[model samples]
Target chain A: MKALVHEEKTGTKGLSYREIAELEPNAGEVRVKLKTAGLNHRDIYTLQRHKPTDPPLIIGSDGAGVIDAVGDGVSDIQVGDEVLINPGLGWKEKSDAPPQGFEILGLPFHGTFAEHVVIPAENVVQKPQYLTWEEAGVLSLAALTAYRALFTRGQVQSGMKVLIPGIGSGVATFLLQFAKASGATVYVTSRSEEKCRKAVELGADKAIDSNGDWHEALGGEKMDLVIESVGAATFNKSLDQLRLGGTMVTFGASAGDVVQLNIRNFFYGQFNLLGSTMGSTEEHREMVQFIEKHQIRPIMDHMYPLSQFEQAFERMEKAAQLGKIGFHIR
Target chain B: MKALVHEEKTGTKGLSYREIAELEPNAGEVRVKLKTAGLNHRDIYTLQRHKPTDPPLIIGSDGAGVIDAVGDGVSDIQVGDEVLINPGLGWKEKSDAPPQGFEILGLPFHGTFAEHVVIPAENVVQKPQYLTWEEAGVLSLAALTAYRALFTRGQVQSGMKVLIPGIGSGVATFLLQFAKASGATVYVTSRSEEKCRKAVELGADKAIDSNGDWHEALGGEKMDLVIESVGAATFNKSLDQLRLGGTMVTFGASAGDVVQLNIRNFFYGQFNLLGSTMGSTEEHREMVQFIEKHQIRPIMDHMYPLSQFEQAFERMEKAAQLGKIGFHIR
Candidate 1:
């Protein structure tokens, strides 16, 4: 099987595209013949932090494909069933936190950046028929994150106002679409005027320049919920735009991590700050159902062949893509 | 009628114990002839921020007394009914937040420091028979804040490990008692060894030195909920003691207001930081019921006559008291 392998000696600079021994399903596991594998910021981090491994490592967190074979003790899912992988490992159900031994796929174990990957049978969910292979492949990680942050953590409701800062990444775009689909009026901010315009085109009610005064741009209208990914640079500003008793949900810190918080202002304003990341297996299932119910499609920036993994990663590293970047694997 | 008054000329330096005209009930209001009034940090704040008015402000928030009169349109409450006032005005029900026009009793309105207080009929709940005047008088503000922080905001439950920092304030002591009553294993931290000892005697499972390494003291055990009021001085350390996806609720900032937060650590650990203050009228009623059910008593440091108001305020300002301070008004 052809795979994208990261070796410690070469690190990210020398990612190799070559043939590797194919994997077989073990007990309670299934082999997926991946049709499409998605690129995420995690992949970039894995590349940058590559460590020595005996046989090199395959890395990717999202994929959609057909189950090629099922191992012993796997009865519910049959071979040839179309499915998408839930990358979160060891988290079997919805919980406040992941259980012990929880991890994401593609780290210690071989991941989805290959022609075939073997995973626990329970990690596979039926791909929504309404979505294309690219959409399904890219939907698991970012979509689940947005779903939990908006509905589960933020408790965003119909007629509520929501804010999304630094809109252009995979999660931010999903946040915009999901909040809008849930009947919330969505607002987005971006450093690029083009990204702001594109966000508005993607159903954002208002798009503010990231450098502008958000409070003034919103005419002093405060948001009921704010989805924040850019951290130190925009955290206080994002918090400032929230209404009294409003919620701000965060998944990542793309810009910087350390931020100064004013405890007096926070308590007096009666705000809620929630930290979220890749969600539970139950949330992944719910996200797929929500997409099917809304007939939502994942936005794709560009699809590269498996051999062009470097270019895809390079585009993500530069933060130039507006949506999910993917690999067209077969 | 005698009242403790704050005038612009004298401020907190010269809070006067003097005569004032007695208040009368208006339509939909009731007048309570106060037997006891409680001192809170808010009273000190009001005194410092005093402004000139035709009539000086009576500054106190918590009181319990017997209703002396009821106005037209007030039927449920009657003369001779023992009652305690809910300091939160305009918050008629429990929800995500207080409604517009919400204000605590002490600042803009005539508060409970006077011999008589006239409030909307709905602001009064029946005083529990189990409580003495002093206990009921000081229970409203601090107890309600603790109740909301632990139950409504923190969602604390039985067998949970709860942490209360700076555990000697009026609110912090209530948090200690309430969390213990809820079946949680309560831990406390205090700068004063005597205060820590008192907290353990009040039912805390363990007491850690405020300046010590709390994680080491707890054997690296993490808290499910943390009630924080000490802000900049201990905010990061307090957050560090929380488990992944744990909740930290804050109501006041006694130290400083600003603190540095590492956003990456927060999000990756999946924490919930909530800001809460005095609770709603509904929560006040519920808190009273819970107190009665648990037979919980408000911890009192000292009770001073109305003429000794200055001494009480001085004790509070110096942080010398371990529990609620009261003015024994007649």
Candidate 2:
């Protein structure tokens, strides 16, 4: 099988596209012949932290395909069933958190950036017929994250004011669409005017410049919920945009990690700060249903053949893409 | 009428025991001849921020007494009804937060330190018959804060692990008692060994030293809920003690107001950081009922006559008291 493998733990220096031994499903596992796979920021982090001593790893967290073979004891799913992978492993239900030993696909386990990948049968869900292969491939990780962040953690409601900062990422775009689909008044911010305009075109009620004066731009209105992924650079500003007793649900720290918090202001304002990450298998299933019911489609930036993995990664590294980047694997 | 008055807004120098004009209740108001009043940390904050130009402010938030007069349109309660004042103003119901124009009793409005205090009739709740006048007077502010933090914001449940750090203050003591009353296994931390022992005696399951290794002390156990008030000094340590996806409710910042937060750790851990203050009128009523149901009583450190206000403030400023400070005014 052809795979995107990394042999070193630092940088993207050891990344390569080459042939790897094909995998066979173990008991309760299925071999997915991936039709397409998606790129995520997690893939970059995995590459930067990959251990050289570990086996050469194929890395990707999202994909859609058909089961080529099923191991013994796998009864609910059969060979030739179309499916998308739920990247989060071990966590099978909605919970306050993932249980011990929980991990995402890829990394220590081989992931979706290959022609074929073997995973636990439970991690496969029927691909929503409404989504194209490219959309379904990239949809699990980002869309599930957005679903939990917006609904589970943030408790966003219709007629509520919702804010999404740094709107170009896959998860942020999903938040914008999902919040709008839930009848929320969506506000998005971006450093690029074009991206802000595009967000507005995609159903955002308002788009503010990330570098502009937010207080003045929103006419001093505050959000009921703010989906925060940009950490240090925008954490305080995002918090400032929340109304008293509002909630801020965070899942990523793309800019930086540590931020200074004012305890006095927080308690006096009566705010809620919730942290979230990848969704559970249950949430993944619900996200697919939600997208289908809303007729929502993933925003695709570009798709490339498996051999062009470097270009896709480079585009993500530069933060130049506005939506999901994909690899058309066969 | 005698009251504790602050003539200026810097330090405690301007705070003095003085005579003030007697107040008369207006329509929908009642005047209470206070038997006792409670001193809270909010009094100190009020002293430090009070404006000299503003009318000399009586600085106490909690009190219990018998109503001596009722204004026009006030019919539900007659003179001689024993009552405790709910310090939270304008917030009549429980919701995500208090409505606009909400404020505590002591700053802009004249408050409970005086021999006679006039307020809207709605702020008065019947004093629990089981409590002493001293207990009822001091219970409102701190107990309401603790009730909201532990039960409302933290969502603490029976058999859950609860941690209350700096367990010597009025609010912390209430938290220890309330969490225990809720059937939670409560852990307390204090710099003073004596205070820790006192907390344990007051029904805490464990007492950890503030300067000791918490992880080692708790035998690697994590808390489901943490009531945080010491602020910058204990913020990170309290957060570290929480289990993944646990809640920490903060209301005060006696040590410092600002702290550094690692967004990555916060989000990945899926923690909930909530900011809460005094309870709503509804929560105040509920808290009173909860106290009565559990047969809880306020822990008093010292009781002084209104003329001895200086000594009481001095003790509070030095942090020498372990529980609610009071002024007996008969």
Q: How does each model score on lDDT?
A: 0.90, 0.92
Tens digits of per-residue lDDT, candidate 1, B157-214, equal 9999999999879999999999999999999999899999998889889999999888
Clashing pairs counted in every model = 0, 0
Mind giving the per-residue lDDT tens digits that candidate 2 earns over B1-330? 878888865657887778889989999999999999999999888987887777788888999999999999998989999999998889988877899999899888999998988999999999999999999999999999999999889998999999998988999999988988899999999999898888878888999899899999999999899999999999999999989899999999999999999999999999999999898999999999999999999988999998888888898887788889999995
TM-score of chain A of each: 0.97, 0.98
Cand. 2 Cα-lDDT: 0.92
**What TM-score does chain B alone reach in each candidate, compared with the true chain B?**
0.97, 0.98
Compared with the true structure, what per-residue lDDT tens digits does model 2 show for residues A180-234? 9999999999998999999989999999999999999999999999999988989
Q: After superposition, how far is residue A298 of candidate 1 from its true place, in Å?
A: 0.7
Model 1 bad stretches (over 4 Å): A9-11, A52-55, B9-11, B52-55
Please state the error at residue B237 of candidate 2 in Å. 0.2
How far residue B270's Cα lies from its native spot in candidate 2, in Å, is 0.6
DockQ of each: 0.80, 0.93
